[model samples]
Target chain A: MSSALPHLLVLGGARSGKSRFAQGRAEVLTGKLVYLATAQAFDDEMRQRIELHRADRSPRWSTVEAPLDLAEAITAYSTPETVVLVDCLTLWASNLMLAERDTATATEGLARSLSTARGPVILVANEVGLGIVPDNALARRFRDVAGRINQEMAAVVEEAVIMYAGLPLTLKSKG
Target chain B: MSSALPHLLVLGGARSGKSRFAQGRAEVLTGKLVYLATAQAFDDEMRQRIELHRADRSPRWSTVEAPLDLAEAITAYSTPETVVLVDCLTLWASNLMLAERDTATATEGLARSLSTARGPVILVANEVGLGIVPDNALARRFRDVAGRINQEMAAVVEEAVIMYAGLPLTLKSKG
Candidate 1:
């Protein structure tokens, strides 16, 4: 019955082990594992980060790079015998906002896709609003959007967990 | 009995409403309120931020500034009829590290002080270990030390709560 869990949302602050926890949860499922990465390698540092993340995953898991159009990617990759893991939603939101795309519409579409997904889906997002308010307008705006996105995704998921110091605290569970 | 609640350790990411939650929690106690601020106004922006925080607090609450000697400040200010709220320990840890003080020793002193405080104390701390690993050594070291301090303080406090997006989730409680 552990494998019968549906959609899960993992939320945490930076370096909070949200991704690692989500990966571990996905690994427990009995199906094809798909890692849908949203981070774009825009610089040398980011390239190295992407490489490091890639090295951490098992070779058996299929990797899909979807910096934008995440809803479509989820729809395309998810199957009845698959577990699709979206490593993050914040990066995807950033990509949308930076590209002048409508984030609310995009988020709604993603929610629609997740609602009908045939297999278990795990989503990871950063909890970025817990710190001091950013000094600049752009950063503050980013925090608001990212926070809204997390709330939306958390509302859609059947289970929501907040990761902290390598610990997972379940906020909601519908297994 | 709400007023009888003892020590509390509030943890959250930046701007995660930790300070606000701590202030609200402290207000509920039937005692003289004291706000122990640890931030050093090193620049104009910081000064402005500090001023804003000061304005948000009630006039009934007395403010105390302690950037490095948190244990001493806590010991000096706490009384049976006073509720002392330390805005943060992370900044205090950073100040100690920057000043070349022994953080472990300082943390130990803080634990000892809180163990015998005369009144209820509310301590705020940042959860800095959630996101991606920092790119530099100093940042990495700071994250490690801040996380360790949080763990130590959480162990000492009678209650520990993690603030997320303006909500307080109790991690531990003895009341």
Candidate 2:
């Protein structure tokens, strides 16, 4: 294990193995693992997916469902010895987009939370650009918002990984 | 008004009239108004502030508060005749940062949201760098995150405004 530990950003398309990759990284960092899940089981398929994820984890891992307050959750749960795995941000952004009264409120909240994260955080996100632009205005907007979110995350993170077909590609890194 | 309407981005220290300035721009865009507020007031102060903003709006203007889905909000609301004003992104970033489990999640969510916004989305963000570096790990991270958020927002935004002492300085502009 490298003595100098840094945050990790793993990006991939849907059904990609980014989550599994992040989980592996977390185990390497610490045994006291914290899984920060951003998805809410709004429907049956989602619930099943959540259940599968739950079943996959060992009882040793502590999981927290933080739909919006990521920074606070990290601060509240993480320690230098703790390894945090945030399953996905795309879903969280989608949830906020669905529920928030406005864009500014969500954006500001995200900015505030990121500035204060406490320990090593592994973030999982989607690569939305590879897909064709959606026909509807709302769909296109989701792509646009997701793109901006990715750019901001990449700017701050120490390392960025792009995963494709279950294969990981390191896009940027600082040692 | 000039055929080339200014795409103004009003930024300032918190409570430093950034929202008010953005509101003024909204007023100027009257008859063609869209107010995109990014705040989800979980506390009394924020709730009251939201209440005041609601009361302040002209009945003709359509209002939408999208916390995370900016692309959807902007596309859903934007029109050639419509002038979309996103009150603040700093808070949105903060919210995402706080709510997500780790930096990667926060960063990814943020990047996606910002890049997707459409129309004349006048953004508001906090300038967090003029002060001293935060003493602890969290504050320092927050500063770094906020700074990067601003930098990325400025890069994509057609125009950028920095408000200090209630003064608006045009940093970069397309018009």
Candidate 3:
């Protein structure tokens, strides 16, 4: 139970039930539920996953297809009355890393946007640090970079929830 | 001359006069010029470059260090009385990419910020696509990402400029 609208960061490993847990949390918040989707359907399985997610939502939930410029979408659609749910930051991060691998520019932009979010934000991110070191330079770099981002976001956001075995554990409760 | 303050994007290779050209545009705009810097010195050469830039600024200008969270910094500092000059979006992009390598998240965030600028913005970016493909995966990825970010920015901005040999040429200008 938190007083006032607070930005939330939800962290978990793959299939760790983070997405399921985020939906449960988002349903509790007031105002319209808006999903800021960052994943693009590259293959059939991904496309079906996206569709299933879409089908799971009630008509009240507004879905914004923001593969890029998610902060802007959040700003545009989010109000004090709007609860913004960004599912899975890992995919978003991957999209950016792979898309803009030459220049390290996307993370700062996200930090700037997160700092200025107009309404409550529920962000979903994957924990990528517990695994073994990558064998290659690029993979190794990605892991390191993702780890740093998670650390920074966890530091700034109001609260962070880590999910495992389909259970939610409060990591930090700034709220 | 455009009635609406032209949103300019200045692109150039390293040491190819992109920053200088951007500064010149800022000088022509009405009201105060806001210089948003994104570079942090990691070495002696960088420190020297920073000093040179500092020395080059006019007393009337205001400078702000915004290595991360540029969108938030821009919203906080810029006004209609200001001609917001983002000294180098490439640096900000690079910072974000380096911090997390989450290109989609960062790119989306920046796109949102650029779309809702409070005043005229003169953005500086590097033309990374013109160079040879990087030998390493990270370098190649970075070049690709930088190119996408630049295209995204240029698409929404009112005017676009590319600098060569320290000379500014209007690549996409309205009015």
lDDT of each: 0.84, 0.68, 0.73
Model 3 vs. true fold: TM: 0.49
lDDT of 3 by residue, A1-175 (tens): 1246577898865444677678778887767888889889998757987998789777878888877676677677767777888876667766777777422355566666777777788888877665445566876676666676677778878899765324456889974
For B82-130, candidate 1 gives per-residue lDDT tens digits of 9999988989988999999999999999999898788888999988776
* Interface quality of candidate 1 as DockQ: 0.13
Q: Name the DockQ score for candidate 3.
A: 0.01
Ten contiguous residues minimizing lDDT sum, candidate 3 chain B: B127-136
- Local error of candidate 2 at B134, Å? 50
Per-residue CA lDDT of model 3 for B62-81, tens digit only, reads 88898978878777766777
- What is the Å distance of residue A38 in model 3 from its true position? 31
Q: Which regions of candidate 2 fall more than 4 Å away from where they truly are? A: A1-3, A101-112, B1-175
Q: State the lDDT at A135 in candidate 2.
A: 40
The C-alpha local distance difference test score for the whole of candidate 1 amounts to 0.84
Model 1 chain A TM-score equals 0.96
Point out the worst 10-residue segment of candidate 1 chain B by lDDT: B161-170
Whole-model lDDT, model 3: 0.73
- In model 1, state the lDDT of residue B87: 83
TM-score of each: 0.61, 0.48, 0.49
lDDT string, candidate 2, A38-146, tens digits: 8999999999999999898877688899887766687787676777778787787787688763545565555455555556778898755432223466766666566
